[model samples]
Target chain A: MALGGDARVGEVVESSSTGFVSQSYRLYGAPHLGALVRTGGPCPAYGVVHEVATRGIDPSRRPTARGEGEASEEDVYRSNPQLEHLLRTDFRAVIVGHASEGGTLYHLPPSPPPIYAFVHVCVADELSAFSASTDCLRLLAGSGIAALEEVVAAFLRHAVAAQPDPQAFLAGAGRQLAALIPGDFRTVESILLRAAP
Target chain B: MTYRESSGRYLGVVVGGSMTRGVDVRLSPDCPVEEMALGQHVVIQGQSRRFYGVITDIALEWSDDSIRANPPDTSNPLIAGVVATSAAYAMLRVLPMLAIEGEFAMLDGPAPARTVPPHFAPVRLASEEDVQVVFGAEDSRHFWVGNPLDMETRVCLDLEEFVTRSNGVFGKSGTGKSFLTRILLAGILQKSAAVNLVFDMESEYGWMGTSEGTGMVKGIKQLFPSRVGVFSLDEDHSRRRGVSPDYLLRVGYNQIEPGDIDLLRENLGLSEVAADAAYSLARHYGQERWVRSFLDVSGPEMRELAADLNVNERALSTLHNRLSRFRRYDFMTERESDESVEEILRYLDRGIHVVLEFGRHRHDLSAYMLVANLLTRRIHERYVRRKEEAMGDASREPRPLVITIEEAHRFLSREVASQTTFGNIAREMRKYNVTLLVVDQRPSGIDEEVMSQLGTKLVCLLDNERDVDAVTAGTYGARELRSVLSRLDSKQQSLVFGHSVPIPVVLRVRDYGTAESYRELGFLEASEMRRQMERDADDLFGGRD
Candidate 1:
């Protein structure tokens, strides 16, 4: 029972105890890094997008490089008709927590989303509520996620922009991060300074 | 951004990872961290409890690591110059003040705990009320010494703890050690909790002394006229200061004791045999008349006396020669005074501070050591008797006494510390209501045992490693405090720590010569009232003229 505003963008392709990989519906609309994505049947499992990539689906097929002399941006895509079936986008999301009827719980989900389950972008409300606590940032920072600092910074900026008052939300997130890593002020300041408008 | 309402002055936020004993704090961009100083108290508001800490270290961390890692992009001079002054974060190392319970307790008051603050807690500057709770309130038992650096609140020391145990005021020369000692003496007098007998070595404590740059520094006697009495060994020097002596500080020939001779052994260059000869002559002629008769003896008379006493002849002659030099000091009277040791004790018992001015004999170590030791020995005996008599009587309180000795290392040094009465008082005087305020330039020269017994140490700048070690030895937080002590300004700054203060603190010592300082110490009121009374008396008596 996905919300009407939520759009399915991918399906689970691989799974692990810590995270899972999903293939996008097309070579476009790949979930942004640090964006929250959910996939499950009745009970929803949540994760933060750690990596997004697009490449030829076949291992032996290497796409020819295009120069900047293209007549128009869309002309290249229209000219390569085989790209639609040959290339695909995939994203990796580290499983952060799960949500039941009770509420959203912060921790490693009981299990990774099952294979082929549809993955939908978490709505703004859910993202805002989850970002209120710095537990997610702590999870991503401590996890074996790729580009950890960059991922955490992106997630903070996205959450701040999604809120009703971006400025207030950014300040709140700064304080939350400060409380999360009080001993590492250097990291906290780095993240907040990047998050600043 | 909407700033959250805070209960305290939000100085910064804890930003770094937790340390074993402390945490790192990133000062808020809006915070005036420039005004913050080391040792300033701060509190961090944790989730469940508050954490207290002091600013131990501060640094600036640049945000751009790429600028240093990669070569400068000199292709665009403007871009290179712009990146050079990029963002720098102010980072502080805060050593948390925890209670002994090992819980993250609030630092709003004076409770002790041993827990670190929760992450990202707002670090706030400690308020005046918090400082009062930590340092303690001003009362008869506590006297305000000076304010902490960069704080408006006053810092005080416990007067009772200060006078009950031996203490040291140590610094290199010209570091305002004398000024601080005078302030402490005034504090002790204000409480009237003890009797102080100051051995004024340079004649600084009894009368106004002149500083090369600052004119006419007031002495303790001038500050508290009713409570202080000045006694001088040189009457002409006292008259120059417009002060008449209370008793003229005369020591009768009988007052010379064997301990006094032993204390002066180094100064007189007497061999062990010569020192023993003086003791033998005392036993033969009796202690009272020995010095008088020995001074009158000729060479043949000394040899005859030496034979009768079974002493070495040459040693006896040397002892006679050394002991006769005292006759040149006018304070050493051949005849006894009607005013005995009991009279001085009586004045002390009534709570009057006594300053024994050395006057012209200030540089004569022999006279200073001999007189200080002899007078203190008699005073120590009297105190012991009084303490024993008042042992079980709840209603009787023995008058606590403080004996201040300058060049204290001379009397309490390694060689003579065990033999001097000052050393005994330094060790055992707390029980007898007597303590020593040992002042010295070379604290390293003082004996280890006596230095250990010092309850409170107010240290100014000391560059010598041994001297610094001597002052900070056996105290809590000595390791951390050593660095703070080393950075003290060469002028009027001191780090006062020990039983009197809860934690070590660095303070700019209070101004001594200002009128406000005098009024705060009650000196102005006491002196002004005395002058008014004198003017009235003059008007009443001179109208007939």
Candidate 2:
């Protein structure tokens, strides 16, 4: 219902029960990949930014290289203000869990974030409560999402800093992953290596 | 990281298990698996009850087989911590033996665990209270025998149940079998109404004996001198050891019989036919004078005697040669009466334990076999007749007797077990209120039937495969106990199970030989005994000179 000024990051451009797409107000302003983010609704849905992309808003027109004639990439963007309007940055966050009445529930929410709802990057305390159990990895483990291991690894890497004991958090996530991942431990171990501080 | 904590000894949770096959406990990630040793007790808190279990085995486990094929790189501290906690972990194989419910547990004692705890039930290292609940506390009727391995709580034996049936103490040589036997003997004397008749082959049960670590340890007699008496086969040797026995045991010529020679068949190196010939010799010379009359026959006299009995002369000569070795035992006499057996019986009649020391004849196998068999046969005969008489009148019931014998395999071997008195005592159990405490190093040499008849057995480390099999055969939970028995430390540790203890336990047999231990064993020092005497006199008479 309410949020901090710095917490507001973007508006929900696309919505689905499993995931949502958010377009940043400023170019390249989308939260870091795997950072946990929330959306506005009666029952707000939490998500992990699994994929990020910067491309032309209109699918028909593809932008050619304008950097070759400029002194630097910044000079091209300054020379053509239309370039900023034409291109956009969008992040696809898989709905890992949702906020509940008593506390955060590390499971899928009843409804997806509303279309055009404001997307807010979660603060440290929110990240702490969500990462405590690391139970959301169950969704990413078999979500049929691409680069699933990398997404889980990246989530652990960013979430550990919010934990009281970052090392213990990483280890807790590994164990949670051990129970969540249905395959060999090597898969879980490889992911852990990527998240090691 | 605080996955679970129950009184801070929490080790794991019951992941999976069965009533018959025990349970698999997934250890908490923070718990060090190496610290969980075999034979240590664990208590599991169930939904409505608690289960007590012993750690029979431990294993390294993974969520998958990849841990074995492609182990995690533990090079980094974070990776190492994660791998240790999650990727690769430990599992404890616990055998839940006893179950206790809330108020019922305090009243009825723990019952056998009939079922495994539910999934994810917390398992903690058994506290002193849990161990005490299962084993019971030391009191007037129970004796503190030892501590459970690595635990301070005393493991007590119900002396009432202990002396009710035949029991055994077994271990390889130098495993403290004799020392443990001394402890049990002292317990029986102090706690129970049963009287002991120990055939002290090494003279270790009377006065004082030498120990591997502590020289000159006090014997059962020294611990309870008023209740215990030493009867020596070699009077001079006993005197040299500073033990003036109550009686000097001298086996008369008339006391020796055919069956006594039969028990010594292996030790005397006599053939079956040669040993059997003694029966005919006894029938000829009369049972009273067979050993002496047979030994007295000369070169031609022996042959002529053998022919007269229709026996092979060479076989008779072999018997004579082996039988003549008994002459070197100066304890042998030509007296007309059986003095030693009567003396032992008289002492036992007075409710006093008699440890018949072999003295110098301790190393002589023939002497030990001859004296132990001869004495037990006469004593058992008297007990059977008295028991029969007592059957007609319960008031005439005699005090229960526990006959302790070392090198029991010789007398209870498969060949001679049917005939020897010791085997009969073991098999007959407590029918005549006469049981046995068989102490031996090689249990495999004993008759299988007698071993099965044993009610309680305390076994130390036995590396011999056949020996282990012999002790554990036909036992409940033998497969699981085999693991516990295999892991016992070589000395001062024993696996005690059966009639006396509620559940099987591995005990770190309490310290002995120290002055402090003597006090713990209820031994009053000379000054203390004097003060006790004064206190008793004060209670009896006035507090005056």
Candidate 3:
């Protein structure tokens, strides 16, 4: 199937066996945490945004004090024309699987995203199809990343929104989590409550 | 549309944890967890097989982190409402029933092989067919006793097993123990599986009695007039209720055995020496005529007789004084009545149920014990003879007989159980086609051996620990069933578990006084038969006018 809504958001700046780093076009509309993004061709590799960071592209660049005037937030942005290009946003996504012609395969891809590979936001269909199974939630829960539960909850919310029946998807995910951690019902309930619409 | 389809009150999903045989179930939002009672049966449907289980325990888990992250705004009703549903989780611990592979092949036949249903199977309220498969279908051998709590299906008991072994009905006052016993007896009669002889100490089983909510509760004789006969120890008292006894229960002085006197020793307040002296009197005057001839002896004659027998004079005097109480009872006659023990046995052999109503003698412990013991002893001996004869010819099968004795603890207590015929019947009567349906409020007072011999126990609400322990003794799932028994409602609820029921179940005894229940129990047909008999009598006598 031809990819639709393929908005180029970043480029693979760093690569690893498990994950990769991607640099966004600018700070505006940087991918949200847990947003499914893919890179590579023919058989594309998929990853979930785990962390996001923003900084000035030039380390020496610094803001100078300006006198307070009747300038609103919009005027400040317009006056500093270089501010948009000066700063850059970068995000880290843990590579989860790769897409095949038959279907979306869920596992570590054969090869990680190459350096400078263009990262594009996955459309609703692709994201929904990738999240049909909850294996990624298990991976995120055990990832030891900062705010692991919060990240899972965010991914669940995005997945539910991408589905046709949000309530059914949320309930299914709740059941999946319940089965996974049958002893720890509190954690499952917490995730469900956070993910509830 | 989703790939999966689920239906039926979405009870929960099976969950796995540290439990091995038990499964934790996470209830769904639509499931009414509050209404789910313990001991209620549920089914978990798997791909290939269905697992049956009972709800043993329930738990409520609160997600602390979820609550901490989104603290309820109690000031706002909407947010508090949202928090209530979102934060709390309910879990049910289910002990699954063992499913043998070849022993139970779905609906085909008994299959064997221990298999647990797959995990994460959807749990649902057990269907009627499912319940019938587990509890046998209502047929000639299996009869409906009551409905399990929260299910439309009828809970049936195996009448064949029930008649082959002794059983017990235990409850505190007003918990419907009598009603449950009545239902069971009615079931037995409907099946014609056994001839029940009820020693009605309260006269409650022979005549109608009033309950609190239900108006008039018809007794066994009233419900089955054609099949049940009421014999009263005090016919005068029963006559007040317009009930004419089929025959007066007159026990001849010659019929009282030494064991009968021994059983009455406590009620007679006889000292050990006095009881021993009575035996010597029996040896001298013969067991049949001793009590009669002893009553006739004068004070000086008794002193002389005691001296000659080498017995205590004062002890002999006390025994004489206690034995005089029988003179007031017209039914205790020196001459044997035409309605002999053979006649009662004949009726039982003919598939007739007999209720020996005590009437005014209901609270007369001595009278009740003497007559119950003497009559049951004769019947048991006759049964043993018939059983021996039947052994020679299989076609001559001895008819199954069940004698229900109220205040059973008095006869089966540790002090006199060895000597009482009721205890013997509870222990060994099954082999002779005779069983005792023991009813009592204090089961703990009964000997443990007798309690263990009971095949099925219908336990009503009992607050006393010892009574509960006694009723639940030898029950397979006593640990889990104890709580179910103890928590029963004090009126019409009971827990029945034993050889008859596959698993322990709590049931509300069917409405006894309702017309529908009466018709269901065949009382309407009995009443119709009575009316027909009355019309025939009128036609024969009124023609003289």
Candidate achieving the largest lDDT: 2
TM-score of chain A of each: 0.86, 0.94, 0.86
Off by over 4 Å in 1: A1-197, B1-125, B210-213, B300-308, B338-343, B386-398, B525-545
Docking class of 3: incorrect
Question: Runs in model 3 with CA error above 4 Å?
Answer: A27-38, A45-87, A96-98, A102-108, A121-142, A147-197, B1-32, B42-53, B59-125, B296-306, B337-339, B389-391, B394-398, B524-545
lDDT of 3 at B455: 87
Please provide, for model 1 over B82-145, each residue's C-alpha lDDT reduced to its tens digit, 9 standing for 90 to 100.
2222334578878776432223122333454466676787888877755666677789888888
> Which candidate number maximizes DockQ?
2
Ranking by lDDT: 2, 3, 1
Off by over 4 Å in 2: B1-8
lDDT of 2 by residue, B54-92 (tens): 888899977677677776777877667877877578999
Top-TM-score structure, candidate number = 2
Q: Lowest-scoring 10 consecutive residues by lDDT in candidate 1 chain A?
A: A177-186
Candidate 1, TM-score vs. the true structure? 0.70
What is candidate 2's lDDT per residue for A30-117, written digit by digit as tens?
Answer: 9998888988666788889989999998989888888888898899999999988899999999998787775677678898888889
